[model samples]
Structure formats: C-alpha cells, structure tokens
Target: MKINKILNNNAVVVKEDDQEKIVMGAGIAFQKSKNDVISQSKIEKIFVMSEGNKKFQELLKTLPEDVIELAEEIISYAEGFLKVPLSNHIHISLTDHISFAIERLKQGFRIQNKLITEIKTLYAQEFSIGLWAIDLIEKRTGVAIPEDEAAHIALHIHTAKLGASTMENTMKHTTMINEMIGVLEEESGSTVDPEGISHQRMVTHLHFALNRIETGEPFHDMDPDMLELIQTKYEGAFVLSQKMAQFIKDEYEVSFPASEVGYIALHIQRVLERT
Candidate 1:
C-alpha cells in the first residue's frame, strides 16, 4: 500500500482496500513521501480505524514508543486471559490513558479512584488483571502506578467491552450495583458472598437493570399474577427489594418501578435460598 499521509518518522497513513490505516515501525516512514510504497519488512504494527476514528492516529503520533509497546503487551495479556476478542479501540484508549497517567505520576499528581472498591467488588477478574498490569507497567517503565490506577484500567476494559463512551457512567453503574448489594446484605444482616453463584446472578441482574434505566427503557414486564405470587411467597426478599428500590431512587434519582422490583426480588430470593 502506498503512503497517503505521513504522521511521523515511524508512522504513516496508507490506504488498503479503500480504507485508511496507520502503519508504524522503526523508521518506517523516514524520508518517505506520500504515494511511496511501504516495505512489508519495515512494518511493525498497523492500526485500523473503527468507524473512522482518528484518535488512534493522533495517539500513535504523540505517545512515546515504549508506552505504546507496554500498552500493547498489557492488552495482549488481557485478551489471552479473557479468551475473547477485544475492540480495536482499546489500543488507542488504553495507550492514551496510561501515557497520561504516567505523566501525571511523574509530576507528582496522584488521583485516587473513588470507585475502586466498587470496581474490585463488581469486576473482580478485570480488577485482578489490572493489578497485574500495574506490576508489569512498573517493571517495564520503572514508573510506579498507584493501586487506584488498577480501578481506572479495569474501567477502561469494561468500557471497551460495553462500547461505552465514557468511564464516568461505568463507574456510576458499578457504584450502584455495590450499593444494591450492600442494601441486600444490610437487610439480611449478613455479607453477601461475591464468589457465590447467587451473588453473580444478582450482579448480572443489576448490570442489565442499570443499563435499561440509563437508556430510558422499561424494565422487563412482569405478569401481574407472578408479581403478586413472588411478593407473597418471598416476603423477605420482596421487602429487601423495596429497600433496594428506595435506595436506588434516593441515590441515583431514578425510579425503580414495581416491574423491576419483582425481578430483583427473585434474584434476592435465589441468594437467600442459596445462602
């Protein structure tokens, strides 16, 4: 493919199959002009834009080579552990975030993530991988990132998985889920085992419930008879669900309708039965 534009000495934009891709390598674009054919042997990495995103090219041009390399290593490791393909946008977003984070740490600007606990509780696997990433970043870059960075990294992974626009909403949703679990535990006078199957189901239920709330979609419709039956049969769970609904409304300023209460009550009942 011929070079369509030059981003830097090591990177250039080229068109292949009528799609623009930014190609990068050591001295790949050095002394090269537009329309010059890039040698395959000199190519190290190629980034394809998702939905014509230009941020990746901008990041590749600006970020330090080592930072980009480190980000790639961490993402590769996460993919192996997750056993699922991640969005291509992860490379851009994560590299940009890590590069800025490293700069901030260098300047002695430390910011703690308030949602760290929620992230650890709700996304244990991703948070664990994020902690591992922290060690790897320090070992490779000699820059010690705080544990809070793990939460930020985990949120980045979560955002990529969900194709979300911002981390703020993801954190808010996580905090909501944690609060819901806390309410359930408080009502039951016991800690919910996060590792238990019931807790996992509750987490899943809360995730989708929050999503629907955010999108202004109605919660799953419950049959009137089933709702009443569940309310009577699982009185304790129904009571806890009421507390949950009120907690959600008070904290998030969003109403949790009765239809959702029945579904949430079922989840609570399952947890109570299992425990």
Candidate 2:
C-alpha cells in the first residue's frame, strides 16, 4: 500500500483498493513520504473507518501517539476476549476519551462516573475490560485513575460492541431518568434513596425501558384491565408516570406504548412505597 499521508512516525495513511486507510506500527512511517510504499510486515494495525466517520482524522492528528496505542491495545484485548469485531469508530472514540481523561487527571480534574453501579450491573463484560484497561493505563503512565473511569470506558466498549450510538444516549437517558425520579419524589412526598435496592431496580427498569423504546419493543403482556385498576388505586404514581411520559415525549418526540407507561407507573409505585 502506498502512503498517502503520514499521521506520525509510527502511523501513516495508506490507500488499499482505492479506499483510504490509516495503518499503524512501530516506526512504520519513519523516513517515509507520500507515495512511499509501506512494507506489509511493518503494518501492525489498520484502521478502516466508515466514510461518514471522519472525526478520527482530526483525533489522530492531535492525540498523543502512545495514548492512541494504549486504546488499540485495549481494543485488541476486548475483541479477543469478547470474540467480536468492534466498530472502527471505537478507534477514535476510545482514544479521544482516554487521552482527555489522562489530561484531566494531570490537571487535577477528576470526573466521577455517576452511573458506575448501574454500568457494572448492566454491562458486566464491558466493565471488566474497562478495569483491565485502567490497570494497564496506570502501569504504563504511573497515574492513578479512579475506578469510576472503568464504567466510563465500559460504555464506549459496549456501544462499539452493539454497533450503535447508545453511549451518548445512555448518558442522556440516565439524566432523564434522574429527572423523572425527581418528579416522582415531588409527587410522592419522598426522597429517593439512591443506595436502596428499589432505586437500583427502578434505574435498571428505566434503562431497559429506554433500550426497548429504541428497539420499538414495548411490553406486550400487561393486562389492560389491570392497568386501569392500578391507575385508579395508585393515583399518585399513575399521574407521575403520565407526567414522566410527557417529559419523554417532549424530549424524544416519541410516546411510549400504554404497557410501557403502565410498567413505569408500577415502578414508580414501588419506589414511592420503599422511600
């Protein structure tokens, strides 16, 4: 493959089959120039990014080479352990996140992962890989990263594995869920205990509900009559659930099915009782 552009001493952009690809290896592009042919054995990794995903181009230009290599190491380990090829977007996404995180830590700005517990419970495999990455980072840089970073990294891995953009949506959904819980608390005259099992279950339920909404898979087994009975008996929870649904509609421009609303009400009622 002929080098089209040089990313760094260790990496270069090359053309293969008339498509642009960035290839990386130790000193692969050293003493190389455009139109130079790269040795096949010197290429350690090739980044075949989607045409729409051009962020990596800028990301590769600014990020430290070692930080990018660290992300590649972690991605390789994750693919081997999970037995799946992740999206090419992760190459830039994860590298950008890690580099920024390392810089933030150096500047004494520690960002906490608010969804650590939920992340661990919901995405165990991804979270495990994140932990390994954290350890690897510390070993290489001698910088201590908070365990919460594991959860943050896990979101990137999970989104790559799913071949979707749910990582950003997950943060947005969690924020919405927290606001919804605040609405529930205001209506029920109770504060949510974040450490309680009920809170965990409710968060899990809402997470799954959002996932279902994305997949267009609303609950199908709830009885219509039972929903009516609960709406009448649990007036506060039902009203709160409707308000939450309206919030969802306003934010998402989509409405949940009746069963989904009913399930939300049931979860709201349980949270009210526990709190």
Candidate 3:
C-alpha cells in the first residue's frame, strides 16, 4: 500500500494492493503531511474506491451524469432530513444509510429501530434534539410527519459531518417557512376551499416538498412521474409564494420578512431548479 494524496492533516488518499483500489479516508499519519508515506492502521473510512486507476477514471467519467445526479438528490434530502451542513461525503454517507433504512421501512418494520433507540439509550443528552425536530415539524406543518421520518431525520441532523451552524440555519429556515404559510394567507385574505382541494392541501404538499429540499435530496423511493408532478406543482407554489409576498407588501403593507423569503427562495431554487 502507498500514499497517493493527502487530503488534510488527518486524511489521505491511498492505494490498497489487495483490492488494487485507491481510496480516500481519515488517517492517523497526520504529521508526515501531503505526498508522504502513511501507515495502514491510520485510515478511518474508505470514502470512495475503485479497482484500478483506469476504473477510477471511468467511474469519474460519468460522474456529472449519474454519480452527481444521484448525489444531488441525496444532498437535498439530507439538507431537510438532517438540517445540517452536508458535503458530497455527507451525501455519500446518507445514500448508504437511506438505502438500508428505506429497505427496512419497506419490509414492514418501523424506522425508529435499534439505532434510533440507541440514541436515547446511550447519549440521552441529545434526545431532546430529536424530539424538538419532530415537535417543530408538527407545529409548523401540521403534517404529523411519520415517526420514522422524525427518527431518521434526527440522526442525519446530528451526525458529526454536519456542522452546528448548517444544522441550525437549515432548521430555522424549515421551521419559519412552514409557519410562514399562515402569514401568506392572512395577507391574501384568501380562504382555503374545503372541497378536499384547497390552499391547505397546497400547504401540505409544500411541506413535503420543503422536507425534501431542506435535506437537499430527492425522494427516489417515490414514483418518478409522480415526483415530476409534485415538482411542477411546487414550482407553481413557489411562484404563488412570490406573488403572495408581493401582494402582502403591496396591498397589506406587510412583507414576507426578507430573511424568511430568502430561505423560501433557496427552497425554491433547490426544489424547482433543474440540475
């Protein structure tokens, strides 16, 4: 095994002879520095791997089309699900976790399983954070997010890779946006129809949409056509939101707080923009 490139003081790139693979991970050889020999025992996790340099090259070749496409969805979902700063690596971690979690959820088992239970069992101090996320979502969106969604989202938001600032900002934006719907209605003086088709329904769908956007991920588990429809509707909602904001300021002398609108715009850009 030999060192390839050092990513940071505590991380490095290496080629493992057994697999003939080049992998990236956190390493113990922090002192030797970049382009220096690293001990095998120091590596923490293999972030990525390829059988050979050519294979690695090939993998990267379609990255723009496939790898990044998939990763973008993962990032979107993680942004909402975790409410944290996520890099491409966080996207990778979430992709791996969600694949299994979704499979388990599909198998008729609840998602708040042993791992979730362990959070309360082990680190009780942060248990309230999970509860807080669920409470905030429930209070703002009125959707009663499935318990499974709450548990998994809590995990993603609290993971080490997600910075505190990122998590806090995302959470604040999500909470505010969910609650902002009421203000829009108040300003518009429009009442939601009660014929099972109303602004209330739009609000609900927007909640779901915001959930995906906040997490910076796509709901691959959902039907592609249906997802497309939902995306279209959300875009329409975004435009409506902008109009409502303008109307509020113009007619009611009230504005959708600029800070809140900025976050709403981010959600719009992430969910409606074609990547």
Tens digit of lDDT per residue, candidate 3, span 170-227?
3443344434544454544544332222333444444454455456655435445644
Tens digits of per-residue lDDT, candidate 1, 1-275, equal 89999877778899999888888777888889999999999997787756535987777778887887778778878877877667777887899899999999989998698667667767787898899999999998888889999988988886777455466788778878888888889889977776778878788778888888888986668899999999999999999999998998988897778989999899999998887
- List CA RMSD, all candidates: 4.6, 3.7, 17.7
Best by lDDT: 1
- Each prediction's TM-score versus the true structure: 0.69, 0.76, 0.25
Indicate the worst ten consecutive residues by lDDT in candidate 2. Answer: 48-57
Local distance difference test values of all predictions, in order: 0.83, 0.82, 0.45
Q: Distance from true position, residue 58, model 3, in Å?
A: 26
Give per-residue lDDT, candidate 1, residue 234.
Answer: 95
Better of 1 and 3 by lDDT: 1
TM-score of 1: 0.69
Give the clash count for each candidate.
Answer: 0, 0, 15
Query: Which residue ranges in model 2 land beyond 4 Å of their true spot?
Result: 1-6, 16-20, 26-42, 48-58, 114-118, 166-168, 189-198, 232-240, 250-254, 272-275
lDDT of 2 at 150: 94
